[model samples]
Target: MKPLLRVVLVIDALLLLAFGLLFLLTPWTSLYNALQLAQVEPALVGQGFGIALLGLAWLALHASIDGAMTRAVARTVGHVNWLTGVLMLVWLIALRSPSLSAFGQLVGAVVAVVLVLIGLGGVRLAAAVRRREKAQAAGAGATGREQKQAEKAEKQAAQAREAEVYQTEPVTKVSPPVSPATGRRVEPDFTAAHQPGVVTAETRTVETRSTQTHTAADEARDAAADSPGAPRPPFHG
Candidate 1:
């Protein structure tokens, strides 16, 4: 609540406090004689009013300082003040109660005016406080929604940035190995690939010639052995 509103509440508290003290002292002091205030039949009745008024004063005073109770208490006090003023006006002028003095009538009117004014001030303050609280609540809700939307947008952007994209390439079927010069598909031959050339008739002819030469040398050795037997060898005797 604003300082002005708080000040209004403070004034309300002071007025209530003054009235409470006056009522409480009615039985002991000349307040009833001098001001021609209402003659409460029982002293306890006046004291009871005093106590209730004092309680209201304490509430108003606390409402000025306390944020939680400010609006509710101010509103209540405002209503009660206006109603009490209306009641006083009716009793003093319309009913003209015998208990109230002529001087008390003027005092009641003045007190009623003050009450009405103070009541209006309190009511205005309470309304302003209510409006301010509603505005703050609305602002907070909007801010929370905006913050959530921003976070969601940021999360989506991050996901987009971190996402992986894949690229695909077309594949072709493979063909068998082919010789570049021979225009033919070459089947693999592990045995012949290691050799210098392909085997031919010349390889067989060389093998035959080697065998014939070995046979002629063996025959010559046998003829020498037979001739040595005729010339008589030392090992033979």
Candidate 2:
């Protein structure tokens, strides 16, 4: 579409340049007579119009070569070109200006038709370019959505694996609390009298010493009574 647009600009440039040159040469030659185009009075006025047309020609040519400028130039030139063609047709058919021969009027009509076609071509090309760009943007958006969905799917898969592990894993048994300082396994206390506390070697040693002390006292009392060294009651009632 862009390439086609450039071609249209080039064609417009050539046509504009041709007409500009013919008008520019009016003062010195009978060239205008060849085309049967009406010569403007005050040759200077025709020359000014020639200059303006030449500028338009250069503008179109430059836009064709510079890719960035073509769309805008094409739209502007296209609209103006068609309108100029319409006015020319009005003048030739309705007003019958310049009093040209039938052949000349036919040529003018052909040029008018060409202008209208070129202008419409530019307009259509710009519209096509716009649609192409819009389609590309929509495609990019779709690609982005696909990527997001893929990532989301992966994340969901990971979470599901975690949940499965949690559900299928074995439960651990609870154990009794242990003493940190003694490094001993502590058992819970019970209400029964015979239930013993932590029985270590230290408790056994203390019980043995108490039993020996009681046995020594009973032996000393019996020996003193037999030896008659112990005090006795003097009388009985």
Candidate 3:
């Protein structure tokens, strides 16, 4: 509750307490004078006590105001209290029993109207408060939802940017070349085709071995010629 409202409530309760105390403290004669009751019966005092108690109840109810109470209920109760106050004033005005009776009734009627207007205004104020609270709650909820969506979008955008960067990056490749000769690392020899058999290394080695064998055979033939039993050498070109 606002400070002003708290103060107003406090004042109302004080008024109620003062009125209650006044009713209890005042003598029966004074009470009858105030109400303008000629008879001054016990029932009249009883009625006054009841009105005082009703005021006290109204004060208590107003003092305990909280958020949980519905605006409608507050409005209804406030109007009821105002109506009852008006009725009490009317009862007092009627007891006056004037010849014209117009003046007192008019005053009483004006007070009743004023109190009723205040009660209705209070109802409107409560309803306004409720509306403002609802609007604030709605705005807060919307803001929270919007913030969540914004965060989600930010995260998704970051992920997308990372994926795009990865996609755009350059790649490298490596492989080995194949060779024809032996399908391996051996070097090819092109000179072997042009000089097919011009005393190649293998041919030269075979020729040298054959010449050595022939010279050995000739020496053996000469030795045998000088011996007793030997084979003769043949003459050839």
- Among these predictions, the greatest TM-score belongs to 1
Clashing pairs in 2: none
Question: What is the alpha-carbon lDDT for the whole of candidate 3?
Answer: 0.60
lDDT agreement with native, every candidate: 0.81, 0.85, 0.60
lDDT of 2 by residue, 1-237 (tens): 889889999998998898788778878647667767777788898888889889999999999999889888888888878888998899999999868899999999999998888888888897787788789999999999999999999999999999999999999987877865488877765645325666656557767777787888889878887786678868888
lDDT of 1 by residue, 1-237 (tens): 566777887888998899899878868757677767766778898899999999999998998898788788888988888788887778877888755666777888888877887897789888998999999999999999999999999999877766632223345766778865588987755664435676656656767888898999999977887884556556864
TM-score of each: 0.66, 0.62, 0.49
**RMSD, one per candidate, in order:** 18.7, 12.5, 17.0
lDDT for 235 in candidate 2 is 82
Weakest 10 consecutive residues of candidate 1 by summed lDDT: 162-171
3 in model 3: Cα distance from truth in Å? 5.4
Q: Return the top candidate by lDDT.
A: 2
Off by over 4 Å in 1: 99-102, 164-237
Q: Rank the candidates by TM-score, best first.
A: 1, 2, 3
TM-score winner between candidates 1 and 3: 1
